[model samples]
Target: MSLWALAWTLVFVATAMGLSMWRRLGLEKDMLIAAVRATVQLMAIGYVLKFVFRVDHAALTSAMVLLMSAVAADNASRRGQRLAGRFWRVWMAVMSTEIVTLGFLLASRVIPFQPAYVIPISGMIIGNAMVASALFLNRLRGEAQARRDEMMVLLTLGATPRQASRHVVKAAVKASMIPTIDSTKTMGLVQLPGMMTGQIIAGADPIQAVRYQLLIVFALIASAAFTTMVLGALTYGRLFNEYLQPVV
Candidate 1:
């Protein structure tokens, strides 16, 4: 079977968007637009990759990594700015997450150099970081806003920003980590993960497929956890007062 064997994606997208509209879920228009945008974007990306992969140049590979970083930063900054103070801080959060994740993955050989490995793994890492950053940053901001009074009280009592924002920090960490946690918990129980299923479908040994799937899952969790902690720590610190104190 080819990659296009996943034609059910279109049907699922249509069904979801349609159901959202019918149910007046407020997400209907956004979902429809997102689906359209994703299609167009992926189509363009497919052609780009076709061209990009033909070149075996080092500069080309670096360019691809840079582009991935920029896109990841854009996705994250768009989500983070409303809550994270300056645009630069959001960029820092995004970049930090990306660096920590990509660094370890590359070093560990969980993902390697060729455009095939580079593109797919980068996409997953960037996507996960984008999500974790968005959720952690937004939630931290919201909690800080809501609990400003309590935080200020703590500050007044000689607590540092780190200490005062401890509650919000914990919540942010939990929020960011939830997806990784759930994926691990549900790995072989509620559903067969796509990587394992894809490998088996491709005629690989079931044991081999299971091994690759386990590696991918663990790598994903590690990358996400690293992203969440770095972004959360960076952002939570800034949300507090200038005196290293939590704000009111």
Candidate 2:
């Protein structure tokens, strides 16, 4: 479709969905505000990305990647109710995961340093980390909050913070990991995800697209696992205190 067609398509669909959501939920103001925010935010990011991609400097590109990761992590933490320290810790974990994975991928030549490789892969991993962290932290914090008495009981019994919330933490991390796991398992069978579908639509061979899909799956697993664990661990640490106690 042409640019104008795509613009109209997006506007109409967004408007229709916003109106429907408002009517159904009786949240006209919130729905309309969110729709406006979505439109403005996407457009702003589009222009900013255009500028960033135009600059061929590695530092500039890396900075942009970091910026995106930070924003995503922040959103994840904000969407979920996490303590400030714990929230920052989750952000740190996500940042570390992105830096390490993107670093290794670039260093080892898995994904080259070009905008094409660097930008897209960073986006995928960051997006995954964002979702995984959001799921993990939200559930982890909520469960830990609910089980505050249990955590205190464990801590009073001489368990460290990590030790105190170990079971709950483990469950939350696993819960967050479930989405990625299910999606991976059902990739080609139940669904052709955006990446695979996009590749085929771009005229790539189906077999090759599947191969690429496998790589993405593996990459996602690695990013999600590392990020979820690190972020969960970090959040766990801050959600507790010096005397092997839980802040929650």
For all predictions, the C-alpha RMSD in Å is 3.9, 3.2
- lDDT per residue for candidate 1 within 82-174, as digits (tens), equals 454534554566566556666776888876767776766666766776777777777777788888888888888988777888888888778
Query: Candidate 1, which segments miss by more than 4 Å at Cα?
Result: 1-36, 84-87, 200-206, 243-248
lDDT string, candidate 2, 1-248, tens digits = 46787677667656766787867966666656886799799789878778777876788888878787878877888745547665577678788888888788778777678776677778888899899988887788788878889888887788877788888888888989999999998888898978879889899999988886787788788888898889766777767756566666
Going through the candidates in the order shown, the clash numbers are 0, 0
Model 2 steric clash pairs: none
TM-score of predicted structure 2: 0.82
Q: How does model 1 fare in lDDT?
A: 0.73
